[model samples]
Target: MNDETSGKASIRRELLASRALLTSRDVEDAAAALAASALELPELAGARTVAAYVSVGREPGTRALLDTLRARGVRVLLPVLLPDNDLDWAAYAGPEHLAPAGRGLREPDGPRLGPAAVLDADAVLLPGLAVDGRGMRLGRGGGSYDRVLARLAAAGRHPALVVLLYGNEVVARVPEEPHDHPVDAVVTPAGTRRFG
Candidate 1:
């Protein structure tokens, strides 16, 4: 791997390790706080549709946020992992509509709306390990969300790209590559930080 790639890998490992240390109670509290903070963002408050994902393991939780958005009469789209690592989306009906998927992910059990469904969103809540001061995000290296960003760009869809993370996950820098896309903001347990 090149320097940038290796650097991202190292940072990702550190972030994941820190997350692994979080207790279930810690995760729960953070989830609630994150949702509250995220809900305050104008991007979400005015959004008619949001593309989001279900949190698994120790990743910053998004369940509360997703439910609240749905409750507000906003169209919430949840991703379904395709075999090739690209994401297909489905409407979020409720907790009972979720089913287990590969990689310990929970996906909406509704009809697959295809990958391009994300273009309908006014905002997208991304899952990430970290986002730098420059708004560049460090994902799990799966390239799924990368494709989502690319698809949005190709279609001229500029949804508000937001990441849900813990307070500590906002760092000074994140190793970036040419294909990497910067987010519009990050919503952490503490609050939201917007970027250009």
Candidate 2:
């Protein structure tokens, strides 16, 4: 593998291993802290509709944040993984309405909105293994969020791009490619980091 590919693989392995060490109580506390930190962001506060994802396994939990958004009556959109690895969004009804989807993901069981539905969001919460100081995100190498970012650029939409990760995942640098897009901010259990 090339340097870029190998570098990303190394980082992903390290981060996932660290996450695997967390206990159930740690995850629960981190989830609550993450939600509080994210809610304080002005972008999220002013957003009418936001695009977000679910946290599976040991990933930084988004459940608390999603529930808070729904409780506050803000429109929340959750992604449905398309067969092509692209994301199709759907309105979040609640935890009760989520069904077990492929890939250990839970998606909202409601009418499907086309992938372009992301264009309507004022903020987007991304899932990633890590993010660098320059706001360049290191995703799971799934090529999913990369396409989402490219689509947003094509539509001339500049919504607040945010990634939710663990505290240590905010690192010094991350490998980047030509197609990679910089995020505007990140929310971790510790606090929030803003870039640009």
Per residue, candidate 2 scores C-alpha lDDT tens digits across 138-172 of 99998999999999999999999999998999999
Q: For candidate 1, write residues 1-196 as lDDT tens digits.
A: 9999999999999999999999999999999999999999999999999999999999999999899999999999999999999999999999999999999999999999999999999999999999999999999999999999999999999999999999999999999999999999998888888998
Could you tell me how far off, in angstroms, the CA of residue 40 lies in candidate 1 after the best superposition?
A: 0.9
Off by over 4 Å in 1: none
For all predicted structures, in order, the TM-scores are 0.99, 0.98
Candidate 2 deviant stretches above 4 angstroms: none
Candidate 2's TM-score reads 0.98
TM-score between model 1 and native = 0.99
True-structure Cα RMSD, model 2: 0.8
